[model samples]
Target: MVLPISRFWYKFSLFLACLLVFWAGFYPEWVEKYYAQAFYPHWSRTLRFLLGNIPFSLGDLVYGLALLLLFWAIGRMGRDWGRMGFRSASWLWLGKILHALLWVYLLFSLCWGLLYVRPSLGTRWQLKPVAYQKEDIRRLTLSLLDSTRKYRQRLGTEAVWRPCRDSLVPWTLSAYAPLALAQRTPALDQASLKPSLFGAVGDWVGYTGYFNPFTGEGQYRADLPFVLQPFVALHETAHQLGYAPEDEASWVAYTAALNHPSDRVRYSAHLELLGYALAEEFLLYGQEGSFAAFDSIAKENKARMDPGVRADRKRIRDFFLSRQNQVSPAMNALYDQYLKLNRQEKGLRSYHAVLSWALAHQN
Candidate 1:
């Protein structure tokens, strides 16, 4: 008796999946560093440039194509399996189980390896304080402007300035390339990270954002006030650029916004760091000056904040402080592990680390 072509194909796919799982688990670093470097960095930007400006609805296009393929596959399977009966059914069930097992094994291997090696990989940079005074803000702003101008000169017209839905595609694609190659998959479904109402309801300041590991999409809720939106947009955009670690994302976004040409964008970046500076001051010095600085900035920011924006921020802050948002011991441990893996010596809590860099340099 001859084996069916479908059975042979399914078995081959299963074998390939198993091989991928083994490779991914044992050699994640090689895969991440080498394979990722080859296509991800350059292809990402090219693909984004090509697809970013397409005007058609991606949802409609994707769903329509998926439905068509699903129906076509079902029809073909039904016709073919009608002749094989129990044998076809058995093969189908077996193939599905093998596929699922392969997926589970791959996921387990990747996560386990990442968790295991995180501590060994370290960061190259450190944060130490420099004097920061109100008088220095103008100088700092000018330095950022110079950096932005230089970067623009280097990149020419292709430089990223404004935030758009497609602006983040390159970053997201690059971040996920390793996983995609490891699993021998085309790409994960990034559409899941698209902004939704559900995400906006939870601890989100009218602008919930996420760096989705599965699809590698950095999604953001775009309805927030302009003051906060630019910074958050840059933060999420950084994640899309393969900066998975939160503090790094914060730093990159801060720099990006600070360098942006617009005054509002610059202010947004400053505010984010200023908030972190205040937090650090409170934790380290515990002086009236620390609180005084925070209060002054808060009052100034508040005077500028739109009423609707203030209400939204208050609602989001309350949600963040609620029981549901409380940090779990396990999560904290994992965070520590992640910091160690990423070479972040200061651990996982310093979104303000960029301030030290900002303070030390003058344009």
Candidate 2:
């Protein structure tokens, strides 16, 4: 009888959610005006200040409690099996689960999901779609690769810029600030980036970072190599700024990183772009083009990577291949479906869209 009342609200919420999602999808500019400009900026900043001082991720604790509650529910269900009767108790749990699912979707929508309908990074930057030739991509890849070598050498030689576990968060936010200003996105600085408590686990799932819609917190996998931190952090920060599409966020991060002043930060960003460009080239023009782009790096410059830097790069690369058991295929599948339902037709592959947008911006 109590569950019936809860189910009533769930039905109402689902109906309203359907209407809102349809309207948001139909007229995104209205979402920008009625939602983004009117509320999110102030709301996110207040969230940032309240949560920033704690110096650790509150979202992590929330998830931990959620898991505990789930297990508790399961145990209770087992105990109640005879008392409540099988069908009655099973019906109760299923209803509660559906109600919970609806509420999570609603919360996600109001908090950060509307951002999925926002204009793309290319639109914000006024980048015209150019018919990119292989020559264009090759040239851009070559230029970035050269710049990457220079900055890698410059940063590597300076022992002071060496990776410190404690300085990671501060350095990431600092690199993000100028890019925010450059892009005229004031909301970018509203929330500080958070380190994932479950970072070691994240590496196995191939997630470098993610945003918590419920908390408006940006979180990066802390277990990542130092060389890979800035790019991942800034990319997550892009989500905090209300870019919902994964690729668009990556583009924003790359844009900011490319303009970053610090040699270490700039090199990290350039290295990320170099990888993206090379991948696109390989897909579009095959291995010959990728090899050509790779060979463009000066031999002397390639040899200049410090032993520590080389190790950092290797650690980042190996995270995907080395850890299999910890990854959750079911969770990944659900997330993939979520992305497709939102705005990304390519689903998980949308993250790579950063490369083309970034290259176009460079030109």
Candidate 3:
């Protein structure tokens, strides 16, 4: 009787949560003013305070335990089906599953997901949007290429790269100082970026970094190319700061990385942004139906880059190519759908929107 009463309340809670989620979609300003600005920072800071200093990921451990519990529950359900029969047991298990899902959604929303509905970082920053021509893209690409060349020249040899990787979290934390919105400082005591427990498997899944919303921890694959690590750390940290969209997070990371004290960090930003600018430039040519011109210009751009920068680019390309797997495409497609469901209209292609943001900020 007590168990049944408890289940009834859980179901009621789930219904209320569903209504709240729907309501949140329609009232982003209320969500932003109340949840993002007022509620999120406090609880997020508390979660980080409790879990951030731990050397290993408490969040990952919890996830592993949850997976095991799910398997055990599935086996239990199979046995219950055979013994008690479907009519007797199925609804009970269904209620249990729904109860679990309700909690997951509530936890996700409370921790970080509600930020998805907030005004975009561009709007928050009040960056004026401008109509950019192909010439603007070409010029931006060349300028980024120049910066990358200069920064790569500043960063010599693999030895310098190692210390830069080691210092990424601190450098990124300092970089966020100027970018903070009101009451939204990302630099927290003990809230250090961590290496992902999944490690090399992340290469197969095609993610360099992710934020554990449950723990308020930013995590990166430890085995990523040294040149790319700083930007990944910064990107994941942006998520920790409640910039939920990939493009917004990428843009935040780009801005922070460029302002980072170390040239290596700035080089990583310029290198990645250069890739985006080049992609935009290529798209512009394709829109004009001049694939031939794009090809010639791309070759020229590569040839003009510093030799060390070109080698680093090759290293990054070779790293991903070598790790390419069948699972990555399926995982990417699923993530694309997830992004679309969360209001990113372009899905995986939204990451490229950073170039447009950059262009707007430049103007």
Two-way lDDT contest, 2 vs 3, winner? 3
For each candidate in the order shown, give its overall lDDT on alpha carbons: 0.49, 0.71, 0.80
Off by over 4 Å in 3: 1-6, 84-92, 129-133, 163-165, 181-190
Q: What is the lDDT of residue 68 in candidate 2?
A: 96
Cα RMSDs, all models: 11.6, 3.9, 2.5
TM-score of 3: 0.91
Model 1, C-alpha of 112: deviation from truth (Å) = 16
Clashing pairs in 1: 118-341, 122-343, 123-343, 171-240, 172-240
Query: Which model, 2 or 3, shows the larger TM-score?
Result: 3
Model 3, CA-based lDDT? 0.80
Q: Residues 1-363, candidate 1, lDDT per residue (tens digit)? A: 666999889768867866875554466466456434444444444433444444432433444565696688667667657777868766875666566567655543342223222211123223444555544543443443444344434433322224444433443444344444544223532422244334433232223565433233345565443345556666765554545556656765665554354554555565556556545544443344577766665565455444433453465455545634344555666757756655466665645556555675332
Worst 10 residues of 1 by lDDT: 113-122
Tell me the tens digit of each residue's lDDT in model 2 across 16-95. Answer: 88667657767777877877777777777777887866778888878878889999988998987878999999998897
- TM-score to native of every candidate shown: 0.47, 0.83, 0.91
Let me know the TM-score candidate 2 reaches against the reference structure.
0.83
Among all candidates shown, the one with the greatest lDDT: 3
- TM-score of decoy 1: 0.47
The full ranking of all candidates by TM-score, starting with the best, is: 3, 2, 1
Model 3 poorest 10 in a row by lDDT: 181-190
Indicate whether candidate 1 or candidate 3 has the larger TM-score. 3
The best candidate by TM-score is 3
